[model samples]
Target: METSAQGITPPAAVYEIAGRRFEVGARGFADAVAEAHAAHQRPRCMCLVVGVEMYVARLGGGYIVKRMPGTGSHHAPDCPSYEPPAEFSGLGQVLGSAIIEDPAAGETTLKLDFPLTKMPGRSTIPPTGSEGDSVSSTGTRLSLRGLLHYLWDQAELTRWHPGFAGKRTWATVRRHLLHAAEHKIARGEALLARLYVPEPFSIEERDAINSRRLAQWQSAVPSPGKPQQLMLLICEVKEIVPARYGCKAIVKHIPDQAFAIDERLYRRLGRRFEAELALWGASDDVHMVMIATFGVCSAGLPAIHELSLMPVTAQWLPIKNSFEHQLVGQLVADRRSFIKGIRYHLQGGRGLATAVLTDSGDAVMPMFIGLAEEGKLPKAEAVANAVGMGAAAAWIWRPGVGPMPPFPPMQRARSLIRCA
Candidate 1:
C-alpha cells in the first residue's frame, strides 16, 4: 500500500524480485534503494562509444543481439547474426569512429565507427506545411535523435524481467551490438545469440504519454529510410530527487539541494546525486525527461506546475529505494517537428536554458543545478516570483512553493558554448 504525505495509506502489497518476495508498507521502497544505491561502489563495465554501426533490436519486447564468440571476425558461420525488424534499419549510423572504453575493463570496451553518408547533407527539412510535421529523416546514420527516443522507451528489464535489474546499461547492450557487427562483417567470428535486454516497453504508448498527446508518433509515421544531417550530444544529470508522496503545493516546495546527510562520514560524496549514482543510471532518465520537457516548452509553457502522483498498485518494484519508483515521462508540442535548446542542453554546461520544455507539453531540467550557477532572476515581484504568470520557469523544485527557492527560468537571449 502507498501512503500519502498526510497519512492516508493505500493498501499492502507483495512483490517478487530475483525469486525472493518482499512486502511493502505505505512508504514503499524509495528510501531503501536510495540508501543502497548511494553506498554502491562497484565500478561499471559499460562505456560510451560514438561513431559505430551496430545492430540493435526489440525482440519479444526484449533487447537481443548476435555477436562473435571471441570478438573475432575471421571465422565464417563462426560469424553469427542478429536480425532486427527490417523497419529497424538505422539504429545509430553517423558520428565517426569513437571508442566506448571502460579502460578498467580492458578489451570489454567497443569502438563504434558507423559510416557517414556519401549523400549531400541537407539543411533543416524544407517547410512542408502541417504535413511537414510528419516527415522523418532519411540517411544511413540512425538519427541520434530517434535513438534517444528508442533508448528512453526501453522498459524491458524493470517492467517484465524483474531479476535482471542491471540489464539496461546502454554500454553493455552496445557491446553486444559490436559483437554482432563483428561477426556479420567478417567470417572467423560466429554469430552467437544473446538477449540484450528482456522485454521492450510499450514505446508507442509511453511516447504518446510522455509527449502528452493522443496521437502515436512512432507508430503512425513510417520511418524515413534515410538518415538526415543531425548531431548527438551526450549529457549526464548530476542529481534527481526521487518522487515522494506529498501535496502538490508541498512537494513543489522541496528544494533541489543534495548535500550528504553525513559529510564527515562520507568524505567522498560528490556534489550531485547522479555523480553519486553514476553506476545506477539516474542520469539517463534525467536526460530523457529533459527531452520531453523541452517538447513542452515549445508548446508555450502550458500549466505544468501540477504535481504528478503516478499510481503504484503492483508490488512496488523499487528503482531508487524502498520508497521510490522509476517514473518515466515526456512532453510534446501539437505543432512542429523540431524544438530548440535541447541540442544545447545535450551539449552540456553553462547556459540560461538549464531546463527545456517540449512543444508537446513535457519539461526537462537537470535533477540539480546549483543556485550559484543560476542567473539572477528579475527582482520585480511579477518577474522574480517563481510561479504563476510571467514567472515562467522549470526548476526541479518550485521556488518559494516549499522550502527552497526556484532556479531561474531558461532564456534564449544569448549563445554560449557547451561544456560536455
Candidate 2:
C-alpha cells in the first residue's frame, strides 16, 4: 500500500470488477475496466469494507468511474469519490423528492417549479427575489437556483483543494458543467439538450464556434403557434449594461452575442442579487456566475426570463461575502480539502456552514463565518441549529469579535480496510 507524507496509508483507488480486485494503476487495469464497461458490469469501489457500487461513464472516448446515485456518503471520507452527507446543505431539503435518481437507468429526473416553455402572448412574472429565496408551495419542486446548485455540486465545482489553484479556467468549468448534465432529465426533456455552455473563444476559429452555438440554440427559437422553448444558460458575467431599448448581459467567451434583459427584469435582477452584485464589484479577482433561462425570439434575439447570480472567488469557490472569501483563501493557503456549502432555498438570515473541512481529524469540521451588522452578530441559536444537524465540531469566525481562530489541525491519512 502507498503511504501518505504522514506515514499513514490513504484509501486505495481500488475497485472490484467482475469479481476481481483491480487497483487503479495496476497493469491491465484499463483493459479490465474497458471489458467491464463493454460487458455491462458494475464496479464496486473498495473505499469501505463492504465496498460501494459505481458505474462507468463514457467521456470523450474514455471511460470514468462514477459513484452510484445517492450513495456518495457511503464511501470513506478520504475516498476520491466521497461526498458529504446530503444533510450538510440545501440538497437534503429536496433530494429523493424533488430530485429523483434512478440507479438502474442511470438518470436523474428533476421536478422544476419554473416553466420551461412559454406562450407567445404571455409575459412571465418578474421574480420578487433571488431564486434561492423562492420556496415551492409543496416543498417538492426545485427552483431555478436549486437546479443550479445541484449541477454545481454534481460537477464537483464546490470542492476545493490547494492543488486546483490556477487550474480552473472557463474551459474546465464548462467541461465539468456539461458532464454534469449528462443523463439529467428535466421537464421530460434531456437537460443536456436544453443547456448551453459557451465554448472557449479563439479568434482563429470564431466562425466555427458561432456556427455551433447557433445550431445548438435552434431548438429554442420561437415558433408562431407553438410554445417557445427556453434553454438554460450558465456562464460568467462580463457586464450588464444599457442597450438601445433596455439592457443586455454580456457573458464571458461569447463577446459577439448578448442576452437581452428587459427593464423590469433587469430591475428585478438588481433587487434580487444586490449582495452578489456588490460583492463581485468590490474585488477584481471575483467572478460573477450567472444562470438563466432564455429563449430566442423570432427576430433572432435571445431574451432572458429568469436569472440568478453567484459570486465565486478567483479559484471558483462560491462565496457569499468578504468573510467567506477570507475563510476560503485561508483554507487554500493551508492546503486543506473542503466542500463549499450552497444555500438552495434557504433564507438569507439562516445560518449555514461556509465550508466543511474533510481532512480534519476523525470527523469532518464545518466552518462558519458570522457577519456583523449594526454591532449584532448572527444569532447563536441559528448557528447552533446549523451545527446540530450532523457535525460534532465546528469552527466559527465572527469578524465582529476578533481575528479568525486557528483551524482544526489536519490528521494523518488512515488506511481503509476491506471486509472479508
Candidate 3:
C-alpha cells in the first residue's frame, strides 16, 4: 500500500493522482512502477495505507496502466481486499517473501515449488516421495499449478463468502482474470496476450468468435517445416471423453469445441497428475483447472504440447481436501479475507500455513489446521522464514480442540483513507 508522490514513466499517456495531473509516454508507466515513482498512483478511498498507491490495471483503449481501486487496497474493513485479522490467516508467510512485484518491468515474480514443464519427452511418472517435498525451482519461474494459483489469487477470485455462492460463474472468473492480467507483463509479453480463456460459444456469436480464433491461431502457424509457436490456455475441464483417435477435453465455456489430447499425451496427463484427476473424479464440488500449451494442426484442430492440472473449489478457490472445505466454509460465513496456501511441491502440510489473512500493515496472519491424531504442529518456522514472516503472528486450529478463533473487530469508519 506504499505510494510515492512524483512523476510517472511510459506505457501511459496521461493520468491524475491525488488531483495532480501528469503525462508520460508508452514506457512511462513501466519506468514509474519499476523505479517506485508515481505513475499509477491514485489517492486511496479505502484502506489505511497513507498516500496514493500504484496498481496494475488497464485503462481506456488497449493501454495497460496503473489503477487505484477504492476497495482493493486491503486497508479498510469494507474494501474487498480487507480481511478479518492478519493473525487469523497466513498472509504473513508470503507477502514480501514468496510473492514479489516489479512495477517497472510490469511483472510479478512468484517463487513456486512445483514443476511446470517436464524435460521434453521425458517420462511422465510422478516423482517418488511425499507431495510436500516437490519444490520446483530452477530460477524464478513458476509451475503451471503455481501460475494458476497466482492468477486466481490476483484475480481476487480466492476472496469468497457464502453470499457469493452460486453468484460466481465462468463469466465472472474470466472477467476477473482478464482484469488482473491487464498491466501484467510476463516474459517480455503482455500476460493477457498469451492467455486464452474461452468465451461461451453461442450459435449467434459462433462466426465472430471463430473468425477471431482464426486470426489468432494463424500467427502460430509456421513456414513450411518450421515449428509452430505454443499458446497458453486456462480453462475449466468438463469431460475427458474419448474422441475419434484419442481423448478430448471438453471445456466448460466452449461446450461445442474440444481440445484433442493424443493417446500419448493423455497417458502423460494421467501419469503425471494422477492425484488431480483422481480428485476431480471424487467429487462434483471440486473442479479441475488446466493450463496447457497447445498448437493448432494444419487441419485447424488444437493439440496439447505441454499441460498441467489443478483442483479448485466450486468458488474457484484452490482446495485439496474436506478439511480445507470445512475451514473455508466457516471463513466464508465470517466474511474473512484470506488466501489459501497451495501445496504445489510441498505435501501433507509440510510447508507454509493452511491459509493467510492480509491486513493494512506489514504483519500478516498465518493459520494452520493441526491434526489431533498426529498430535503435531505444522513445520512452518522454516516456511515463515522462507517467506520473511518470522516475526509475524500465527494461529493454529486443532479439530476437537474447541471452536475456531473469533474474527477480529472491523476498522473504525473514522479511520477511512479519504481520496481527494
Candidate 4:
C-alpha cells in the first residue's frame, strides 16, 4: 500500500532474521499504488522485515520477499537465503572489502576487478607489459572470468541438497539470478541492465521474449547524437561449429543469430578450455556457458570482441570433471554450504581444492577429490603448498576410498533445511 523513497514496493512481512520472530508481515506484502499517489507521505519504515532488513524485489512471476544473506540475519542455516562466508569462496579475493551496501535503499555498490570498455576493432585484455602495478591494484578488481563466477555464486545457483533433485533448470536460474541482481548497481547503472541472459528460445514465445531483450542492450544501440557502446552478453552454448574463417558459436536462445569468432580467438578458446568441451560433449546434462562483449554493426550483426567459456553441472555450479561432481553430490547429501572453485588464471593440472565445504559445527574445509592412481593426491598437496591459507583443514578422497570420510551430523539448532 506504500512506496519507498525510490518508489519500489515493500515486502509482505518482516521476519526478524536473527531473532526468529515475525516482526512485520500481518497485513499484506505488496499493493497497487492507491489513487492518492502523493496523498500518503509517511516517512519510510526502513524496510526492516523481522529483525534483519529486507527488500522487495520484482522477479519470477511478480515479486519476491527475501532478505540480505550472510548478515547473520537470514532465518536459518538451511534457508536457501543463507550464505556461506566469502572466504569459503573466491569471493573474498575479488571483493576485498570493495562492496558497500545500503539496507535502507536496497542497493549495493561493488568495486570491479576488470574493465568494461573496448574500442572498436581492437582487444583490450591489457598486455602483460602494460599491467603496471598489477599486484597493488589486484584487490580492487576481478578478472572477466572471475566476474562470471562471482555472479553465479551470489545467485545461489551453486547451492544444492538431496531435496533439490531434478528441480533445477535454465528457466528457474534465469529468474532467480535476474531477481538476485535487481538491487545491484554497478558503475552507476543497474547491474541487471548490464547483464544479459538470453531467454529460452521457442517458436511460440519467440516474438514476445525477443522483443523484451532490447532493454538489456538499449545502451549499446546507436543513437542519432550518441555513439554506440559495447556491453556483455551471457548465454548457453549450442555448439562452437567451425565457420569459413574461424568458428561460429550457435547460442541457445537466438537460433537465427550467430556470433562469429576469428581464428585466433577460436584457437585460444579451444586450447585453454579443452577440458570444458570434453565434459560438455560427454554428457547430456552438462551445460556450457559463455560470456562475451559485443556490439551491433551497421548491418545489425552482433560482433564479438572478447569471449570466454565455462562448464557448469546440471545444477549450474561450475565444475571441471565427474570427480568434482561426485564431491558436490556428497556435500549436498549432507546439507553443507560450499563453494565451487573455478580455475580463472591458474595453470592447468595444478592442484587446487576441488571445492570448499562450510559445516555449521566444524571449521571450514577445503576438499580434494581424485583417484590415487591419477596422481591427484600429490597435486592436492602441491595446491595446499601453493595457496597456503584460509582452509581450516584438508579433506581428500580417491577411487578406492569406498565411501567418503564422515562429516559431523547436521547442526539442528540453527538449521532451516526442510530436507537432507
RMSD of each: 25.9, 4.2, 8.6, 9.4
Query: What are the per-residue Cα lDDT tens digits for candidate 1 across 1-420?
Result: 111222211112222222223243325333332332344312110111111122222233232321222221111100112111111112222212111312122222222122222122322221222110112233222232333322321221112122223454544433433333322211112111211111122445555443432121122122245432111112222333322321111111112212111222122122222322343343333221111100111122111111101111122111221112221121111111111111100212322221222111112122222234344322223222321213333434323344443323322212111111
Q: Identify the superior model by TM-score, candidate 2 or candidate 4.
A: 2
- Cα lDDT, model 2, residue 60: 48
Best by TM-score: 2
Candidate that would win on lDDT: 2
Sorted by lDDT (best first), the order is 2, 3, 4, 1
Q: What would the TM-scores of all predictions be?
A: 0.20, 0.88, 0.68, 0.69
Q: Which stretches of candidate 3 lie over 4 Å from their true place?
A: 1-46, 49-100, 105-135, 161-163, 333-337, 343-349, 357-365, 370-393, 398-420
Pitting candidate 1 against candidate 3, the one with the higher lDDT is: 3
Question: What is the TM-score (0 to 1) of candidate 1?
Answer: 0.20
Instruction: Give all candidates' CA lDDT scores.
Output: 0.23, 0.78, 0.56, 0.56
